[model samples]
Target chain A: MSEQEFTIEALKQILLESAGADENIDLDGDILDTDFEALGYESLALLETGGRIEREYGISLDDDIFTDHRTPRALVAAVNACIKDTVTA
Target chain B: MSARTVITGIGVATPNGLGVDGFWAATRVGKNAIGRVTHFDPTPYPSQLAGEISDFVAEDLLPSRLLPQTDRMTRLALVAADCAFKDAGIQPGDIPEFDMGVVTASTAGGFEFGQNELKKLWSQGSEYVSAYQSFAWFYAVNSGQISIRNGMRGPSGVVVSDHAGGLDAIAQARRQIRKGSKLIFSGGFDATDLHLGLGRSDRRGRLSTSSDPDRAYLPFDAAADGYVPGEGGALITLEDEQTARERGAQNIYGEIAGYGSTFDPKPGTGREPGLRRAIEVALADAGVEADQVDVVFADAAGTPQLDREEADASSAVFGPSGVPVTAPKTMTGRLYSGAAPVYVVSAVLAIREGLIPPTTNVELSPEYAIDLVTGQPRPAPVRTALVLARSYGGFNSAVVVRAAD
Candidate 1:
């Protein structure tokens, strides 16, 4: 699949895996609208997840991505943009 | 009646093992966990061997959020606390939040973390240093994080009283429980890997420079020279007797009968009477006599002078016959502030199993008329145990633990 095809579901899975099985996170509904703190994630978790996404997508992201784009959908879009930039370059 | 404090759960990240069962099995057979240092290059230092928790991967054990905020020492402490909580069958929200507390100890907190952050500031820029670096290196970080993570909002504190701080932390835990806190997670862990602190502090010529793991830390032996530094920690669940019984906690390890601390008036100022006094006070506070102590977990400082002082102190307490002494730390190098808690865990296990784990890599010195248990595990009715620890700067602490009556 192309970098543009990266789905919000994929990002949701990453967030769930990062949070661990014990955490009470809802994956099916409005994951993009959910606050990371609501999912038992803190700033460090967001930073770590950002790092993992960067590695997985073969791209680099700004340190402020978590602050600027605070949801899974927004993070996925940012990740996609980075991946597309890498591919085009 | 005083609020009786008991160890209901034990969690340890030692060089020997991870949890209570693994630690007990390793200690039972006198397994050696010290090896050549792998965390950092040891060529520049005098000591080559260290009892490091090489297998631990903090990311795998802890929550993702804790990864950035924790140093290796804090990770070890949190993991041990996790194990202790699990072993006690208690979860974060299981009990009343205000009734639970934490009391931990550390000598060198996050030495490696602070060192790395300083390196970033030196080479890159001040902006490159992570924000978490500020609190991550503090000695009280473990207690604070453990409390925050577990929702334990009761009276929480940290002890910074050298290596004996581990025992002192436990002593403080008992006091907290008596003063109203129903449960407390108390122990100690230390890491000296990156040399921001401990490496420079060993200038007193006390650390062992031996390259061989087997001969590196032969405490109480005639050939004893110095001790190998180690890294790790152990935390135990200290609960009120009524609280534990109410929760149906079946595995009661032992009770903290009494604890005492003394200070040697700065080395050479006087005969090191602090250790002797600490032991005596602990026994008296426990309402126990020296004869009632089934086993003695000795400090076993390994240095010729310190070992002699400890031996003299033990002899002074136990008299001519002498109590059976063992230093299981031969299996894992002295973990600085963490040393005493693991020894406390060992004592509790010894009391439960009715056996004294042998002190490995030692030949009993003829000069010291102490029955140092060596070679193999000794079967004994260990109804009570006396554990001892002393810090570098004249501080000494002792605790008397008794099997549940």
Candidate 2:
């Protein structure tokens, strides 16, 4: 499958696997614009998620990706963009 | 008079058993948990026997989020902390967060976790390493993680004096209590896989190479060789007597009455070892005569020279076979930083139950002028107990526990 195929569902899976979803929050609900702190995903948890993504996709995620993409929607877009660039190059 | 410090709750993950009841039951019966190492392949190491918590599955006991971020030792410590809080009937918000503190001890830190990350950095390159490596390998991670998870914002610290650190951490917790903190979680735990490998490679001379579990770690025995390393430990919930009484704490285990520590004199100076002085100071601090101490939990190094030194020290303080001494660690091996705290747990339980647990599977040498309780549990009127521990680098520490009024 193309690296561009990275989706919100994939990001959801990674987030759950890396940091675990908050007990009270539902990941299936509308949470795209919600802050990570609200979802109980702190900086360290996001760093671990980034590490897993890089290892699985064979791509390098810039350290700033964690700060720049604060939610699943933004992180998914950034990962897809990096994958597209890697394929094109 | 100053407020007394008592241990209201205890949690343990030990080779022989888990939790206070499980560990105490096994210990009372002299159950042996040492065997061929199974945490990792022991074929490569000379000392094959170890006391491993063979049945512990961390995923079954802890939240999944914690598994990725923490090392095995930290997971065990967290569970122990949870058990301690539950045992004490104190929830996170039960008391003000600022009134609770954590003081823990660690010798190997996260050796298994660090070794795995270092392997990735070497063979698979640095990019393959996990981000958790930033703090997971630290010696203070146990104290830090316990405090963060429990929301304990009061005084916190980690002691790293090897075996002696267990008592040192308790002493530190007592100090925090004296400084006005209402409650403190203290003690330690160790995960011995990579640490055991390293010990075999660097200090194999001090580890038991025997394959038989029964004969592997016979401290004070005529056939004693060297100690078998073990994993797991205990975390105690300590509160001021007035606070526990005012809060109606269910089970007051005993009081952490007194503590003393000293470093051994440099070799060749002809100055005697400091173990005796530490014991004397602990007794004096407790304001009790040596005769008042009903039992002694010996350091029991399991090596002839070190065991002789400890025996001599005890004999000097309590007279020739004056006090009944036991090393329940024979069943669990030497747990490094975990040893002394577990002994403290045993001591308080002994005081409560009026029984002294045995040093299993050992024939004491007649040459040592000390009374070694062996083979079976000894029923006695145990009121005050003394626990002793010594580290490889000459650190000696002693703690006194007594029946709480």
Candidate 1 per-residue C-alpha lDDT over A63-86 given as tens digits, one digit per residue, 9 for 90 to 100: 898888877767777778878888
| Residue B314 in candidate 2, Cα distance off native in Å | 0.5
Residues A1-89 of candidate 2 have per-residue lDDT tens digits of 46456788888888888877776889999998887878888888888888888877878889899789888788888899998888887
Residue-level lDDT of model 1, residues B1-405, one tens digit each, is 686899998889888888899889999889999898887677787767888877888878886656766788998888888889889988879879999999999998788888888898899766456667768889899999899888999989999987899999999999999998878999999987445443765676778888889988988788888888888879999999888988899678889999989988765566556899999999989999888998999888898778888888988889844789999999998888898999999998998889999999888878887898999999999989999999888889999999976
- Give the alpha-carbon lDDT of every model: 0.84, 0.90
Q: How well is each residue in B1-405 modelled by candidate 2, as lDDT tens digits? A: 678999999999899999999999999989999888777777877788888897778888887668878888899999999999999998988989999999999998887888898999999988778788999989999999999998999999999999999999999999999999999999999886554453643375888888899998888888888888888999999999999999999989999998999999999898899999999999988898999999999999998989999999999999999999999999998888999999999998899889999999899999799999999999999999999999978999999999996
Return the clash pairs for model 1, or none.
none
Q: DockQ for candidate 1, please give it.
A: 0.12
Compute the lDDT of residue B302 as modeled in candidate 2: 91
